[model samples]
Target chain A: MSLRNALLAMLTSQPMTGYDVYKNFQTSVGYVWHAPDSQIYPELRRMEQDGLIRGETVPWGKRGTKKRYSITEAGVESFQAWLNAPPEYQRERDPVRLRAAYLEWAKPDASAEFFRAHTAYHAGRIEDWEEMIAALRDQSNPTLAKRIEGKSAEEARRITAYKVFAYEGMIARARAEIAWAEKGLELVEELERRV
Target chain B: MSLRNALLAMLTSQPMTGYDVYKNFQTSVGYVWHAPDSQIYPELRRMEQDGLIRGETVPWGKRGTKKRYSITEAGVESFQAWLNAPPEYQRERDPVRLRAAYLEWAKPDASAEFFRAHTAYHAGRIEDWEEMIAALRDQSNPTLAKRIEGKSAEEARRITAYKVFAYEGMIARARAEIAWAEKGLELVEELERRV
Candidate 1:
């Protein structure tokens, strides 16, 4: 359902070929909602079949044709209904956190190695998110710029604000992970010292 | 696989009836891993058939025998292997965050209502987590108490530390959500004022 809604949201910017949608997904929606190309392709087909989106064959090259998609009136209405619907009950699951809760069962340095990797991983995420934030701020982000391409200045600002706020939330999350892992490293050190 | 391993972890404390496992799941391992009872019972059957856990028919005082499950030697081996394995890539999906990213399409008051609800939700989560931390600290938590029931004082403290650390990570996350949502509320207010 979310993938469907995300696809509808993506089409809100403009008509997109499957390739365009997948490419935009990788850089934008995929950051918040991870879906494989396999998933996206099928969902796009389904949305077109459901009449929430309309598609037409377009020339991809001299030898190929591609299906390009655009939102229908129904699509916009569907998206609005979903937005106003109650948020789904989230099931938070983290393999790292789950493993961390049982680390005492493992060899001592197993934890140190894990936390080090955890910290480094989130450090990279922080960098990615910062780049995204900057891109959105400059209106240089491809998918976002398309979404706001012809809107009134105030409308564009509102659109950009919503996305920046989302990425900023992601940045906060990545920072939190880094902080948690660093604290984990400290706890491991303290435990070793006590023993 | 996480659910299977979590089942194995639960059995590290003691053999339990399926009902007991579900009850404990609500309080303990479920903290880090979320699986409903519907998923648990079938997984329990699979684990038993896989010989990772052994279930035995135990006498019920007056009538039918009940099955209680305990981890087998194979289960311990399986758990250790999983702990040493590389962490799986996690794809985080947050519906609220996803919707937030596109809120410009929504009515101003809709976002205000959403963030207000989001703020209240995290506040409750913070309280729930703080209570969990306190229970662990006092050795009054049933799950932790069971896991450390016969361990040496030093071993017990080490085990407790890992879990307490996990819960603290959760607390940090809840606090971050509160912060994010409060900021969201302010953004909505500013946008509404400008309009």
Candidate 2:
């Protein structure tokens, strides 16, 4: 997702300081998309210049001066138009797989160490995603809950069901990775000891 | 990986016509990387100008002349240096998640239908990857298998294991999506009937 569009979407929901945008990313949108403050703040400035969003620098009670951004008429129109356009294509460059391709270059012991850590990292991510989904389910907003409502007994079980599913897949894959890693480690250790 | 580096590496294995590079993409490299003919041919021309690779016109047995390419010493040095360098960082965009984000704006039924097809597509990919792995396993080349040896057990495992894990993850995730889509479809169908 374009950081600019994400910022505009947040502003349309309500006017927000850049700090507020940062918070939204951490709590909600960050689950699927991420932009560090470095990217966000700069994009915000560019958007202001383009007249897609208007910003006002205001001093708050204690938080000091911060630029509060709101979607301009043009911003909303732009976002709507963007929505009608085709989604950007997805591309993945999995580091683990790439490194795996060149594994023979490394000593067996070192390779084993790498896979163990790699599998563990993905497992952690899956766990974090699950925890986030659980928290979303417990959210108190009626409208949010309604967004998850089902006609029958099956569908109403969760909010962000898609994420939950995706996470489950990730977890399953991680486990498989762990299994493969363990087996590889055993084999490599033997080879290393012999060599 | 930069297509530049990838193309350079391929040339080091042997000289190839632009058509050969294109064919290699479909056969071996597409498993890890992809490039269209449009990108490949233009890049070949660019590399020739840069002196990274040289192209020669070779007459085919039956067909007209083809532009065959071979890596210059500079190209071989460049590719090996790249292999030792850090991998380029990549950002991935998931269109299914993007669609899910805007699900609120979609007809509930329409949203479900989209996921239903999306789930099936992912499921097919997982199955296909599994088949590819099985075929590779049955191949007799020890050099290719040797390519996987010597890494840590986890690393070695990661070589072949990660793909299966990733595939399984996709399947599980797709199933979860299908379940959610079915619920959404049921709800929308009920509403339609009521009207």
Candidate 3:
């Protein structure tokens, strides 16, 4: 359901070819929500069929045709309804964390390796989030730029600010994960020292 | 696959009926990886079929027969293999964060309400995590006690420490979410003032 809303939300600004939607998803919201093209293409087609969006077979370049999707009024209402709905308990299903829960069964060195990898991974994500924030600030983020193109100055500011806030949340998450991993590494070192 | 390993890990303590597995999953590892009884029951059957576990029909209290499952050598090997495997990127699908990304479409007060509710929700979770950690420290946590039974002092400390580390990571996550939600509230207020 969130995926459907994400697709509709992406089309709120302007009509986009399925390819454009996929590319935008990969670059922008993919950090918050990841969907491969296999899921993205089919979901686009289904949304078109559900009448939440309309697809127009328009000219792609000069010699090709592509079905571009745009949100309908129904889609806007639907997205609003979703946004206003009460939140559900998000089921946690993090595999790395799950593995960490059972790491006592592994060697202490392997446990150290696990946290080292966790630290490095989130460190990379911290960079990704920072880069995204920079992109959003400079109007260099095409996905967001397309979304806010025709809005009033204040409206555009609100739109841009919301996205920036979202990435800031991600940055905080990454930083906390890095800290947790470092603590885990310390725990491993202590265990090895004792064992 | 992780669920299977979790089921196997839970059985490492002693033979547990399917009901026991469900209860343990609800409290202990369930925080890290959620699985409903529907999935749990079927997975248990599959594991028994695969010879990773042996289910014996034992008399429960004086009433009826219940199947209690125990991990075989194969199950132990399989669980260890999963613990040592390389981690994969866990795709994030958080609805609150996704909704936050599109809050510009809502009223400023509505946006503020969203973050406020998020703040409240994770605040409650922070308490839950804190309580769980306290239980772990006091040796009153049954799931952890079972997992560490019949171990040397050093080995038991390692096991207990790993579970604590996992819960600490969860605490870190909840704290980050609270901070993010607070920041989001500030962003909403700032946007409203500017508008």
Tell me, by lDDT, which candidate is best.
1
User: Of the candidates numbered 1 and 3, which has the greater lDDT value?
Assistant: 1
Q: Predictions ranked by TM-score, top down? A: 1, 3, 2
Tens-place lDDT per residue, model 3, A1-195, is 999988887888778987888888877888788778899999989988889999999886889898988899998989988877666766767677777777878877778888888888888888888888899889899988887788898778888888888888888888999899998888878887763
**Fnat per model, in the order shown:** 0.64, 0.03, 0.64
Which is the better candidate, 1 or 3, if ranked by DockQ?
1
Residue-wise lDDT of candidate 1 within B131-161, one digit each (tens)? 8778888988898898898899988888889
Q: How close is candidate 3 to the true structure, as a TM-score?
A: 0.94
Best by TM-score: 1
Candidate 1 chain A weakest lDDT stretch, 10 residues: A85-94
User: Backbone collision count in every prediction?
Assistant: 0, 6, 0
Candidate 2 lDDT by residue in tens digits, B1-195: 467866774565568898878887564445455678999999999999989999999898788788999889887666655544433433323444544554433444455556566556656655655665664455332323543455565544544553344334334444555565565455435533433
Residue-level error in angstroms, candidate 3, position A49? 2.4
Q: Please give, for residues B33-127, the per-residue lDDT of candidate 3 as tens digits.
A: 88899999999999999999999999878798999999999988988877776666667666677788898777667778888888888788777
Residue B163, candidate 2: alpha-carbon lDDT: 38
Q: What is the TM-score of each candidate against the true structure?
A: 0.95, 0.62, 0.94
Candidate 1: chain B TM-score equals 0.94
Higher-ranked by TM-score: 2 or 3: 3
Best by DockQ: 1
